[model samples]
Target: MSSLLRIVRFTRSLAPLYTAIIIASVLTSVAALAVPFLIGHATDTVAGALAGETPTGTAVRAVVLIAAAVLLAEIANTVISNVGGWFGDVMSNRMRTILSVRYYDKLLHLPQRWFDSEITGTIVARLNRSITEVTNFMKMMSNSFASMLITTLAVLTISAWYAWPLTVLLLIVFPVYVWLTSLTSVKWQKLEAQKNEQVDIASGRFAEVVGQIRVVKSFVRERGELEDFSRRFRSTDATTRAQSSHWHRMDVIRRAFLNLVFFAIYVIIFVRTVQGAFTLGEMVLLIQLMTMAKAPVESMSWVIDSAQRAIAGSRDYFRVMETPVDPRTAAMMAARPEGSRDGEADGAAGSAAALVRSVPGAPVVAFRGVDFAYEDGEDVLRGIDFELARGEKIALVSESGGGKSTIVNLLLGLYEPSAGSIEVAGHPSAEVPLDQLRSRIGVVFQDASLFSGTIAENIAYGRPEASEQEIVEAARRANADAFIRRFAGGYEQVIGERGLKLSGGQRQRIAVARAMLKDAPVLVLDEATSALDTKAEIQVQKGLDELMAGRTSLIIAHRLSTIAEVDRIITLRDGVIDEIGSPAQLAASGGIYAQLLDLQSSGDTRRLARYDITA
Candidate 1:
């Protein structure tokens, strides 16, 4: 219920439009109600004429006037109802836009850890289902609720005026029917929630399977995937059957009570009219009013069903919206100047510069006693410490699961260390605004991670404001300009998803160009060229070398030969720094780096396997 109220409050911004819809609905209801009174008057006129107590000419005129009035009322009702519906459509779409934008914005501010535990498909599915249900429910209520309430109230009032006893009988139907429906509310909602979970899981898996169709086909798991999908939906189907049976059984009881109440009212009305206790026209008017009142009662089940769905949907929506955003990121976002492009806040830059000036000769990047562990897990990195001077290049070499990537992730503020602290550009990483901090560093991952867009768009992604000449220059430096120009569209050519249309080298070069365009003071290469063949690696490495010039570079390399040119090598063993020294110094030091080099030179696959390194 609270969730439903919160959804209603979201409409406060469009109150004027919503108010107009309600006003139009009320007017349409009034017009529709006029028909019953006009019909009753015409019936009395005809009755008087039949009794020969009134002139036929007068009766004919009265009937004609009443019939004309009824026609005009109906026309007005139709026009007003249509206008109100238009407003409802506009408001509902606007509501959807509002909700979608806010949801996306919240997602942006959420921490990476929040996303780490969630599936891409499930996240997207929740947004679609929740928003659709909420908007549809709002639109339906806007179009019909006001009119229903008005008609119900008008019918009851007019009935009471004609005969108090019949109105009392009709009133009894509402509470009794509502009470019966209430009996199923808790259990019905429980079943509905269970069903929604199964449906969400099925929908989430469907999206995942489609997105990874290539993998599924390669593994020949089509039958298995289909069976799993079918099994999930079968769970939903069983739950739905239970939910329906419960609702209809209760509905039967409610409907039976309503029929009995109406039966008594009808019998009394007919008997009184035959006994001359009521006029013929009064009896007709009373019966029509009673029917009008019954219409809302009959549709109550549908209204409640829709309302419950909306409530459940809204509960899911608010669950995400209400999750606390990462406070550090939130503060950074709030501090950013409005209308500024990403990471271009002049004030933030000035503050960062001031901190640098105050701490002269600070390391470009540093880690001090850093320790980290994932949620409820043992430390992946422990008592780690290192520093990168300005314009220095350092390589990190380690076996698998040695926390090499975790170090980079912490530097990027993706995760906070469980113990100790890190500093970047002379300021504590936590103290620096995220945009400003990230703006100073550029990263190219093992995967190119390119989106489907023009080659120019991918190159200019980090700096969207880069000029055409600048983009071309960056691409040339990355050795991507040649292949890009080979395409008929040149730089304007669109790359397929994740740059699948291009070779490994081509995609990596585009990523390099993007990093080049960013031109930050610091760069990170996370095994950027390891996926390519010898010739491709050589071609991509040239661009990487150019990008690394005159900047602080942190390299994570699995191949021993690739780090020969690095000024220093840091080797990790079991989450602690095993050796740190110049590449030549470590080669002769007979440490992990030296041992790995020996193993590589000897081509001893078994020994290399012990170190978790591939030759």
Candidate 2:
């Protein structure tokens, strides 16, 4: 009931359309009732004329009037039906648009944790199915129920005027129908909920298989995947059958009981007519009224069915919208630190020296005693503290699970620290609005994810409003301009999904170009060149150097060669900084950095020896 009310409240703007629909439907239904009465009157007058009890001219006029009324009723029904249909379609589409926008907006604000835990397929299926059901429910309520209710009432009122006994019996039967509907509705809702869950499971499986087709092919698991999907489909089909059977049984029972009562009413009216208490025309009127009453009673089942599905879908949809949003996305926009230039912390061209010159010794980013843990998981970071001075280049080198990426996640405001705090440009990271903070930082990840679009479009993703000249300059700076121009369509060449049409190094350079276009004050490269061959790495490394030149940069790399020239190196172990110094200082100190360097050199030597033997 609450969900239904919520849907109504959401569509309050459509109240005028609803009013128009109901008014047209009521008029149409009222006009239709007059047809039966018109026929009854014509019958009695024609019978009297045939029996010589009435004038033939008067009977002809009555027949003509009845025909005209029937014609007018049919025309009115058509026009009103059209009007009501138009209102319903417009209302359904409008509600769909409103709900779709709200669903996406809520997703943007919802906690990242929810995204991590939920299945993409299931979420999308629920979103689409629920909106459809909700729209259908609203349409039926306006177009069908309005007419049904009005017809039922108008018929009953006319019956009462003719004979009170028949009307009273009908009024008594109406409550039984209502009571039966109420009794079955709860069970119907429960069945629908279960059916929907089965659909969600099947949807999730289909999405998973399609998205990972390559992996399945590589593993030769196509047969297994098909079997799994078939099993889920069978389960969904079974649930659907159960739901349908329950609905059919309830409908059958409701119809049988109503028909029995209607037969009893018919018998009473027939006997009354036979005893001369009612005329043949009056008997016909009673029968017509009974038929009209029966229609709405039967229609009650359909209305409730749509209502149940809608209510169930709405409950799930509302759950998502009502979930708590990520705190970072919810943060209000904050002012730039006092005395900082408008583009000082926002431009990639702003060199570290310029930043230090403006505010000496102040860090562009700082983390103080930060600690973090995943839900029900071990601590990933503990009492970790670090700072990147304005205009300085730093590298974080660590084994897997050393909390390097965790720090980046915290700095980006993707997650909150369990304890302590992080500051960016003298403002708390948690306090700065997420979009504003991210706009000031550029990141190039190892995987280099891309959508299916032209090279220019992908490059301009970070700053969609970037001018052509700006795009060209950024591409040139990232060393991607030359290769992009070689394509048949130049920058307009369509890249396949995730830029899979391009080589790994080409994709990486495109990602770098995107970051270059963003031109943020801070840059983070997470193993950006680690996945490339030697030749590719050399090419991508140059682009990285150009991108990092003027910004305060943080490089996360397992390859020691990549971090050799950074201003400082921070080595992490077991969720805390194990060493921090310049590369030369750490090497001379014979610390973790020096040992790792020697180990890599030894491994390279063995690789060369093996290559010589193969040659």
Candidate 3:
């Protein structure tokens, strides 16, 4: 998108202030023009009065009135600027809001692997980066450029009226200043763009190190991390210095050029005075007005420079905007009937795959020949198929990089398949609004994203309307109630950003409690116990057990011991399902499942047998 159009669209959200702001800009410009006119009129009127050889009341009155008028215009300009400033702020805020909304919507549409594992840190950098470009444009439009443009025109007009030859001479000289400014600004803007990229990478690196500070300390890798940071920091520093030098160079050239122009004009004006036409006052006022006009033009260069950077920054923003979201099977579909599709087949098979929708109980989750790949074209999940009967629990087991987590992501609609499909309840996963689909499934990942907030708030995140009793019940079910109650403030205690203040097990328990509070028919636990202690693991397992009852559950466990109790253990290898059966059955079959079990046996086979005691 064109930068101007992007800026306009960005400002569209500030409809309330937009009209008032535009008018204020025009008025500010006109008022600045009036300054020279006021000064010129006042100077000429006094000159004429003195020429008449009398201290006339009319001259005195005119001078006072003109002075008063100039004062009034100055006052009005300042007031209008403040009002315009408020509107500028409104526009800047709305632009940021629009950017944020677009960013979040893109996040929803984006395939998971495109971000690799650095998604969270990238997300943090995005949020942390300054919106200086947008804000600068708004401020310049209202406070700087609008009025300055008017003042420039006004000064030139008056200068020509007083002395056309000088005005024309200065006008010829002006474009050189403008051309030089433009050249340097483009170079500076490119440097700024590079600096912006460095800042993002640096900021992302900072967040990454901070997130893994514990590991850094444990491994004594602080020096390594700091050195890595120093490399990026030096790059940022070089770009910043380059940008600063460009502007400084432009300033020095403009100042020297202005001095040369002013000297030429003064020498010419002095000759005119010696030849006996130009007065002392005219030359004095001419110099002052000419200098005043140059000031805005000088500042105008930086304004243009910032405007260029804003345009460049938006390339990243617009690149995100250009990508397409997943296509839906249908624009709309009614809820699927209650009871199994096997009983009646849901929604007449809305395509090859349809989501089940029932009035009561939980949503059924299913994947049909779902194939997916990353942006790099490396396929992660091959054409695989399965159905999670309503309220049935399924645990996913696989060696590392077996696309186990990819399955959970597909079920959650984070990624649509390269071929095949995913269905929720009875509607195609792509067919249902993703937010609505996600609303029906509560997910808890190994590193559960916990925002800085209270335990109660985080637990009830998806279900903001959940009652206090419901929240407490969820905490109790997640095996978090005991530890939570022991805390001084119970549920009111803050979790801190990403639950950094809490233990890994504590965060995991809180995540489980959050999913439980959601009360969705579909629940996901991706390595839910990976971060827990033996005691905490057992406690969390009890909570998971209670939470999974009568819910369609999908679990991804790194340790084989974790999934031994699930209703069905589906083993994945190289993106395809190798086996699907109860743990004991899989072990007896003596395939990948038995091999995995031997690696991480916790002697909990009876406990594993609880969720799926194969009849």
Candidate 4:
């Protein structure tokens, strides 16, 4: 009931249209009611003529007038009902639009951590199912409920005037039928929820499998995947069958009681007419009114079923909406600039770019005694301290799972530190608005992470309003222009999903061009060349060198040779800083960095495996 009320409240903005529909529905009910009365009057007039209790001419005229009145009433009912349906259709679609847009907007604002545990397909499935059921139920109610209520009330009142006993019996059946239906609601909803879970899991896995089809094919797991998907759906099928059986068994019992009560009603009306308590026409009118009342009572099961589904759907929808958004992410969204790029403020002077220029001598990035952990997990980094001055370049050298990427994630505000603080551009990182902080930094990941779009679109993603010439210039500096222009569509070529249509080198270079277009003061190359062949790495590294020029750069690399040009190298062991020095100094210091360099230099594959380091 609360969910139903919430849905009602959510659509309060469309009240005027709803009010119009209700008014039309009432008028339609009134017109329909007139038909039975007119037909009954005509029957009496004909009977009077046959009994010779009135002139035949008088009876004929009265019958003709009654017939015309019935025709007019039927026409009015049809027209008014259609108008109400039109209003309902408009309101329902508007409700759907409002719901879908808000859901999508909420998704955009949810934090990364909230998304980490969710499946992409499950989230999409929930949105689709919830919105579809809610809107469809609303449309059904808007079109039918008003008319049903008015018809039921008019029938009951008229029947009571004719015979109070019959009215009492009809009223008794309603509560009994409703009580029986309510008995199944809890159990039915439980099964429905179970079914929904299985379906969501199946859908999530289906999307995952399709998205990583190459991996599945290489693994030869197609049969296993199909069996798993079928198993989930079969579970849903079993739950659905049980739910359906329970509901129908209850329905059959309810209908039997209804049949007995209706039988009693008909018998009473007939006996009363025979005893001269009602005229032939009055009997007909009473019987028709009973039928009208019975229609709504019989439909109660369908109404309740739809309502339950809608309630369940609405509950799911609200669950997502009610989840707490990260306070920092909320602030970031609230502070987003209108009609400007994502991290830019209102104008050039107040933008993050300007902030970078204002703090020329301060450390561009700093981490002081920072501690970090995943949710409910041991710390990945502890008491880490680091700083990068403007135009300085540093590289993080560490074995796999040694917290290099985690540091980059924390620096970008994807996650907060468990303790201590980080500072950017002379201000505590927590004090800096996310948009302003992120606008000052650019990052290139090893995977490239390009979407399915034209090459130009991907390049200009950071700054969508960048001109063609600016995009081309960024591409040229990233060493991607020559190969891009050779393609049939040049920069306009469509890159398949994640840029799979391009070679590894081409994709990496395009990612480099994208970062170049962002033109941030601080650059982060997170193993940008680690996934490429030697030739590809050489080509991509040239672009990386160009991107890092005159910028405060933080590079993470597994291969020790890549850091030879960096001003300093910070090495990690067991989630804490183990060494910090220039490459030559670290080499001579015989620390973790020096040991890894020696292992690589000696080509000792066995020794490298212990550190999870790969060449």
Predicted candidate 4, C-alpha RMSD: 4.4
Write one digit per residue (lDDT tens) for candidate 1, span 435-522.
Answer: 6678888999888999998999999999999999999999999999999999988999988877878999999999999999999999
TM-score of 4: 0.91
Instruction: Give lDDT for model 4.
Output: 0.86
lDDT of each: 0.85, 0.80, 0.72, 0.86
Sort by TM-score, best first: what order?
1, 4, 2, 3
lDDT by residue (1-615, candidate 2, tens digit) is 779888777667668888888998888787778878887887787778889998899889879988898899888988888888998898888778777766766666565678888888998889999989998898888887788888888878888887777788888788887777778777778777887787787788788878777899999999998887778777767777877787788778888888888888888889989999878788887888888888888777777777888998899888876776655553321222222221111111112221112234567999999999988688888888889987799988776667788888788888888999998887777766677778889999888988899999999999999999999999999999999999999999999888988999999999999999999999998878778888888888899999998899998875666678899998888888889999999987776677666666676544322211100
TM-score of each: 0.93, 0.90, 0.82, 0.91
> Which tens-of-lDDT digit does each residue in 1-615 have in candidate 4?
789778777667778988988999899889988888998888888888999997999998899899899989999999999999999999888777767766765677666788899999899888888888888888888888888899987888888898999989988998999999999999998998998888888898998898899999999999999999999999887798899999999999999999999999999999999999999999888888888888889898998999899899999988887776645544444543321122112121232322323455778899999999889899999999989988888988766788999999999988889998998988888777667778889999988999999999999999999999999999999999999999999999998998989999999999999999999999999989878889998999899989999999999875566678899999988899999999899989989878887888899877775554555
Pairs in steric clash, model 3: 341-345, 354-426, 355-425, 355-426, 355-427, 356-425, 356-426, 564-608
Cα RMSD, each candidate: 4.0, 6.8, 7.5, 4.4
Task: Please tell me which model should have the higher TM-score, number 1 or number 4.
Answer: 1
Best by TM-score: 1
Clashing pairs in 1: none
Model 3, range 542-562, lDDT digits (tens) per residue?
A: 887888888878888655555
Q: Which portions of model 1 show Cα errors greater than 4 Å?
A: 331-359, 605-615
Estimate the TM-score for candidate 2: 0.90
Off by over 4 Å in 2: 331-361, 604-615
How many residue pairs clash in all the candidates, one count each?
Answer: 0, 2, 8, 0
